[model samples]
Target: MHYRLEHADLSLILALVRGRSLARAAGLLKVDVSTVFRSVRRLEAALGRQLFEKSRAGYLPTSLAQSLAEQAERAEQALEAACVSLEQGGEVISGTVRLTCTASVLHVLLLPALARFMPAYPALTLELSTSNDFANLNRRDADIALRLTDSPPEHLVGRCLGTVSYRVCASPAYLSTAALGDLERLAWIAPDDFLPDHPSVSWRRQRFPGVVPNYRCNSMLSVAELARAGLGIAVLPDFMSGEQQGLQSLADVPPSYDTALWLLTRPDCRALRSVVTLFDELARAIRLGHAGGIPA
Candidate 1:
């Protein structure tokens, strides 16, 4: 085995290992699926070892593949650290800050904060990536992230914004003819398996055992939209549902579910003035319930 792996090869392997699907890996790499497939095939041929096994469940990494992927992740982290080091040495406080969070959070929380912060620091540019998946702070996929978690990752440092609360909401049209006594009997729009561990899901399971939702969606925004359209009642964050038109919270379903909101940043990136300033502003906005531009 005289083969030497390149950074590109390692990156492909890492993407495949993490994404678990050719399409997903391609998306992450900003390439086509054919490109990913060809690259993986070439790497496997060069190493004379199978990296992944394909099945209906998607690509499963072999032991060697996992080891290589881990190395690639380490390399990524090191590169990010180096970048942060260089950023810290610079005196300029203006630059692009990449931020990531769930779509709901971006719209409900960060958007208002951003509206205020961006104008104040006109020289600062923001790149926002909204998704349900947690961005890899270690890889610098995002410079900052707003997350709702009970236990924040040890590797990251930031401030706890506040406690996020959820409530069951529905449109007035739907509630007019709806049965409010038995929650299990009401039409429900629930989060899909992607959010299986969400507080709302857990609350629903505990409150209405063995009950199935009438509709299910992966996006919290979609669930809220469907509820607002009179499709069904949805469990939504207070910030998301509070100011929506024609939507009313069910008094029967008390605000019993809550989670901690965190403004997280990589330790190395914390030294950057832009990151620190943004982090402080976001923390303040969230703590004061000012992020949504409405009273909490």
Candidate 2:
């Protein structure tokens, strides 16, 4: 009666049957250990049969699992063929992948990466939504996501893509009229999300060293705009100021402190070929794009 086979869930079952341990199965699947545990439970619930019996030592395959093992093998092959049909059309690979990310990444990093991806995979169409808000993975709102955090939510699985570091930056014209000593006299624009009232803003406040701004604004775009208009000095992620004309790094921020940029998926959703293929391609694009050099 287990006619329902979600590709990702089915793969987890196959991995468990082969490895006999959730931890080991997760490793082979390139996902965290917790993800393997949840998938196994979901599989049990859906099939109404216990596939594995866990002991202190390891998992023992149930008679039911033994009976279904061969069928699972067939299912795996079917999933593979389905992926080929969805992502590749002869020479071209195409699918619609939706992603949620921060404004900073949407503008600075992803734009260029996609330009590279499109030429490589012309069949692919990307739907990117950017905001400070985090999407609920349980709702299946986004097929993939990029976040500025290290660990993912309990039900999600992912890896840190890279680090985002900040530096003190100012315009060429403003730098001429001002000095670091003019700290007290300078105007500063700060994102409300990173303001003193917010808990996450603690690091930003510590980094400024008493330099308060003449003007205040919220969001990265506003900060970039104000800096472009010759408003005042502000601490910005290096990539933001790197490409803009008026902005220049006033001081090389030591890289010791950095925030992680992560790539993620709903743990259960990983089984979908559409999601898996896109996640892999995007991760590759981000990695290769970084090696080429961070976009200005």
Candidate 3:
């Protein structure tokens, strides 16, 4: 008996291996659970072998299936690389570059650079994903990422754009009679668990361990808005706070908190012309303080 495997079958196998469950694989494939089950059964019947075993934990791949999945992954990567090469070799650089970053970065840094980059490269299309969560570059979840970190992953290749400075700020109305020494006495807008290790949170904890925030939010933009409304003092990235009309940095509070901003990409993705162009533009913009006037 002769059996042939199709690209779709290989893709299904790869997705199932990665996802480890029919439901999850279906989600990845954007297909129904029943379809995934049917397809897997068909493949097994054709091959006269069970590729995966259903366990209490999830779908566990057999040794043979694992090998096949690895081959499928290699195929997928090679196909993607070919596509990227073709797009890069074209006269006009054109392709979707998926970029991920924290919401604050999107608002204060990437957006401004993107505004300039888009007009310059009209053929390039960008897909932006903003979240506080780190995007999985190894999994190709994002081709490029803007990150604020002291220790970047060694697996990725990128340039350190600049250092981001942080300061405590409040609306002029809220700070009218407030003294810098009495920061603990005033209400505070604090980041939630989403940013547990954020410099602002650490600074607040170290300076006023006993004080509890009057307001808590996960988003940096929300904290800024709260401070702007004269709600409370908030520790904000200088890039976000500097240009706001009503916000005033506490005179006595120095910009004590800082972190490195990095524009990172996967080694393989960096070879694409579009990725390289965007990466360079971002590094240049950040270094020049042109993106949201981010301080060098």
Candidate 2 ranges beyond 4 A from true positions: 1-92, 136-138, 193-200, 207-212, 243-246, 252-256, 288-296
Question: CA lDDT of 227 in candidate 1?
Answer: 91
What is the overall TM-score of model 2 with all chains considered together? 0.59
The TM-scores, one per candidate, come to 0.64, 0.59, 0.64
Worst 10 residues of 2 by lDDT: 287-296
| Candidate maximizing TM-score | 3
lDDT per residue for candidate 3 within 1-296, as digits (tens), equals 67898889889998999999999999999999999999999999999989999999899999988998988876775566567657677456656688999887888778878787677665666888887655567678998888888777778888777777788888988877666677778899989988899988988898889989999998998898898899988988877775454688873334566777877888887679888888777877766242331221
Arrange candidates, best TM-score first: 3, 1, 2
Over the stretch 164-236, how does candidate 2's per-residue lDDT look in tens digits?
7776678877777776674545777666545444222444566666755566666676777788777777777
Winner of 2 and 3 under lDDT: 3
How much is the lDDT of residue 47 in candidate 3? 93
For candidate 2, the per-residue lDDT at 75 reads 64
How does residue 192 of candidate 1 score in lDDT?
95
RMSD of each: 9.5, 15.6, 7.7
Query: Which consecutive 10 residues in model 3 have the weakest lDDT in total?
Result: 287-296
